[model samples]
Target chain A: MRKTLLAAALVATSFGAQASAPGGSGCGWGNMLFEGSNGMPMHLLATLVNGTSGNRTFGITSGTNGCDTSGALSYNGENMLAQAGVMEEVAQDMAMGDGEALTALSVSMGIPAEERAHFKKTMHENFNTIFPSEDVTAEEVMGNIQTVMNKDKQLASLS
Target chain B: MKSINLALILVLASAPLWARATNEELAEHPRWKALLHINEGTTWRYQGRSYIDDPEFFLHESGATDARAELEASIEQLRPAESEARCDFPARYRFLSQQLDWPDDGALSHCSDYQEWREAMPEERVALIFPASYLNSPSSMFGHTLLRIDRGNDEDGVWLSRAINFGATVQGQENSILYIYRGLFGGYPGYFSNVPYMNKIRDYAHLENRDMWEYQLNLTQGEREWLLAHLWELEDIEFDYLFLDENCSFRLLELIHLARPDSTLMDDFRFAEVPANTVRSLDRAGFIESVDYRPSKANELDALVDRLSASEQDLALALARDASVAEEEAFQALAPRSRNLVARAAYAHLRLQNREGERSQEVAQRGLALLRVVNRTPTVPDIDPQRPVSPEKGHGTKMLAAGGGMLGDRGFGELQARFSYHDWLDNPEGYLNGAAIEAFNARIRRTEGDDLTLEQLDVVNIKSLAPRNRFRKPVSWFVNGGLDRRFIGSKRHLTRHVQGGPGLAWEMGPVIPYAYAMARAENNSAHDVLVSTAAGARAGVLWYAESFQLGLEAEGLYYHNDDRRYRPSATLNVPVGRNHALRARIERDGGPDRAETEFHLSWRYYFD
Candidate 1:
């Protein structure tokens, strides 16, 4: 009976990429942020123990910040979004003119701390041109950001 | 020539004895045992054998059981000038090198694979991350814990930090019952993986809407390196994954124990290693340096919507549903700040909703347009959601209670115990509000003139009451199955039952009201039928405050056998500090032929 109860308790306890091109799938941003096998039952079971199906990632493969280092756009030999797949976060922060993502992006871009406020202001002013459209690719956004940065006197040298 | 040969043979025979004498103490060290995952006992579950199931992890055939044999084999394996053992077991190499007189021949320096990997990691700091529970998803009801290897340098912030996660490797298309069965019985193999902190943030916060608590650990640089090296050893290693004991939290505590050899972080957890309880253990060990909170995307949206006026919130919802609403007079008439706030809220809404469906062009265009308005306006302050009490501060999971009550005309004494988790009446400081998840709850009662009998045994009970509002409409739900004692024809009979349903809930300040339509199946010994089915409805209102909680609920059921039952109950609970509480409940139960009134009072003590 104790064994049966233990089994019952156990049952209850259980119950509780690449940088090929800016617009390419390798760039990591081409896929939607929340795209995957998201069946409700799967989520319920997967989250029960916080388990994943066959994800065997070694720390070695996560280059820098798990971003594709082969991205076309390079800053200090590192792609801006290459270090972090936070394009949406960056976009939101860019609109607000300041955020953790925005600051991290600027730092990755080698922008000086003193020039960040100016960088934020410039990005804020050029938000429309940078974003252009809701479907704007991350590469296109980066290009537009560089174009805008090149126009600013203080930001031009950094860009 | 024979005498020289004999002398060489004698020397060779004595070398091992000499070596064994010196290395015996080192092999017996606790650190060595921890490295092998050898605990005291003979069984495979918790004691005796190594926790790691992978045979490749052990050098000696009996290495999993005999630490000395493994240690000696490791030494022999590492003696070669070109041996890759140093790279495979760098932590062991470091430990052994300190104790033995190994030649400093730069073998470790030439391992480019290990060198390049180490260089990629900062190894300067470590943090324990807890993604708070998401009640809507029952799997996340217990929450989860992982470790983050911080790069130390703030150039990219902690977003660039490496996250270490331990989880079971399961099949994607498996059935749910099989999944649960395998998870409970250690059928799946668990492995440790490393990814970027930002990716984890996206997974937990943005996708799942679970608030994250990051606790920076205070470990010496040496300890951090030891942990990192051991983590490398564990790469691709397999351990039989069990849902209760040898789980993610348990594995991480083992790593921490390896780092701080003197700390007893893994001692208390033998049966279960709940994530929140692990955090509390870390806090008690004084290993926590500081804590930071990251609000989920849904939480941020809630804060943004909360800052708006009623009319503005309505306008924001309209803008989210239709892009043309931005052209309206009411939206256009708002001040620039208000408009920016409204647009931001709408954009957040679209992003959150995108989690459910495929990305569509229409939603994208609307979100982009809203962002354009936000960008055009002057910058407003970022939305800041109020951080609730961290999980470590919450009451423990295991609970024990004792009380005396009256049933009909009989006086009774009751004792109850719960194996895990939060209930609605418990303190809600660190748990999800309106969420109740309990498992293995049992109650026994002794009536005035009767022997002690089992009153109830709840195998599993879960309730998620996410309140509906103007911006979000989350459904409330509950499911429970267990053995219950019922009064049938003047005698008590234990019945097995399961019931569940969906409902609606609303929050208004301190008060929350909810209603549910339920369906139930029961097997009672007194009933002639094999199984009985019932349909019912339940309604309740709860008032929560810092000092106490009050609830009033009523339920009625109609069975197919022409039996009917109604129960109305009121409960009050007052917390006494963090680990104790007092509760009182009064309910009247009406059946087809009899009615009984029950009053109960209990004092509950909680612990991990």
Candidate 2:
């Protein structure tokens, strides 16, 4: 019972914080760009659409440090998928870096112009928040979004 | 070489008087005096050219003869002038009689002839070669004769010679003695380590040069024998050679035969260093330093020689030193040491910047060569114990450890535990066991420490599982003991158990195989111990370069002695990191009469 209360308290605090944040007030373009679609960094959505985990995460059973960490997160299907996305992005960056080519994610959702403009500014802030180095610029993020589109077409052709 | 000889003449001129001393006169010289005083009345003999003795004549009242004093006077009767020149005439040998035997001087018949000794002995008796006159002649004096006049072959032989000083007299002595005093024994006198073969005059003689004098005395059977035996006793023998070389320096001209036995160095006077710069210079001038530390004009000559021998180590060493030969390209052609050196260098290069060189292939080849040499060095194995063990020529994995144990109260009751195996030894075997015992002490608080209750204890319980092979059945068992408790308190005493049961097992998969099983709890009676039957499956998967696994088992327990039991209990376990795991288990309690559900969450630790 005490553990349940602690978990409830954690969720309440996280939800309350999420609600007060700018775009986090609703599940619109604001939230989409401020925090990721699923309480993760915004860059991950575009990353996951093009990655593969296959048979790796099937037997995962525990998490060691926390949800964002992989140890026990292996069994956390959503987290595993999220990690697969990050791994693919890292692998692609490394592979391309070998050729001296740099790329980053780009995002686009059909929303109000004012909302979209706000979302863009919010995403810029979020990007800085996630990577203190601010290495992924707005232009790179746009490029990544375009890549996702290209990848979606490829996946569509395969289907 | 000519300049070297001139320089040597100057050194000899500097120390003009350290030559030879007769036993009696030498008794007064600082260094020689020490040797003569070792034992009293012990005569030292020198059989070669000259000899000297100390004499002191006393003039007393006429006709007054004290027998002892008279003998003393007679013994010291040689006149002062005569004793100064003849009494100290240098003998060719001066050692005591005990050191060494005089060998026949290289086929010379001096001792065998009984006839007049005719053969002209060489300057060096050991090498048996005569030295040129200029090399052995003393400065400012005539050459002299030295002879082994001893009638006996051993220590009993007597040697004799004459003094060759400026104004010495040799009136009636043999010409051989006269020849020695006037003709040869001149320069610096050399020392002989053995007893002299002959003595005719005084106890000391001067030589301007030792090398020159040694050259002359190194003649004659007896003289050479005595000198060679004593050459080791010469002070500062280790540094005597300057340009002592046979093929390279002229000083070695006389040492060709004087080298100490068992030495490979050229007479301790001449030799060359391996890999001398001379060869290095030649190799750069379009030549290869051959197997002998000498340069060869054609590389093909060495290549052909090496090709003929299945394993040519020498040619390999030569090629290794050839800077023009790229190690990467020539490694396969070199011998083991050269190859090891080059390979190690290359390995060091690759390790820079985290670079990975062709280590796998290079190491394999070098390892093979070392193995071959180890196996082939000797034809007989029984005597040579340093042989290498033959290499196995196949692939395989090794499993080295597998075991498990449990600790708990010994009473028959209820309990809990977990089982695990840290190392999966080989693919074939893995071990683990989990168990819990009951009838533990119940606690209450009171004045005297904490009150303890040793109630009527229940049975002790146990469960275990061990995987043996991929396709073979794994072992599993459960045990329980139920016996009355003997002691009771907050701190309970000894408890006992009596129980037994059947075990379950199953196996599957390839390469990385696994299995599971269940066992019965013997704490309860047969009816209450409704032997549990469970099936568990395990599978391994690689996740991002790391390996991970999961296991799930479900079973039901029914105690035969009692009917309160349940079915379809299950256990789920997942390992997330090294040595740690989380497990969730669900089981029925009591019996079928009134079974209750129980669920448990546990953390487990495994050690390597």
Which candidate should be chosen as best, given lDDT against the real structure? Answer: 1
Report lDDT per candidate.
0.75, 0.24
Error of 2 at B60 (Å): 77
Per-residue lDDT tens digits of candidate 2, residues B213-308? 111122345434433322222211211111101111111212212222112222221122111111222223322212211111111122223232
Chain A TM-score of prediction number 2: 0.19
Across B1-608, the per-residue lDDT of candidate 1 in tens digits comes to 99999999999999856664377898877788878887644223757668876877988998887788999999999777667888898888888876675778776786787777887776888999988876465546567778998768654577657778776554334444665677767787777777767778877888778899999999999999889888878876788877666777777888888999788775553666678877888998989989999999899998998899999999998988886787889988989989888999988998887865467888778777777777766666856999989888998889999999999889999999998777887988888778887777899999999998999988777777889988888888887777877766456677777777888999898788999999877777677886678899999998898799888999998888878878999999999999999999999876867779999999999987
Candidate 1, chain A: TM-score against the reference? 0.59
TM-score (C-alpha, index-matched) for candidate 2: 0.17
Can you write out model 1's per-residue Cα lDDT over A92-154, one digit (the tens) per residue? 888888887787678767788788889988988888888877677767878888999999998
Off by over 4 Å in 1: A1-60, A63-85, A112-114, B1-21, B40-46, B80-82, B175-178, B488-491
The best candidate by DockQ is 1
Candidate 1 residue B41 Cα shift, in angstroms, is 6.1
- Fnat, model by model in order, equals 0.24, 0.00
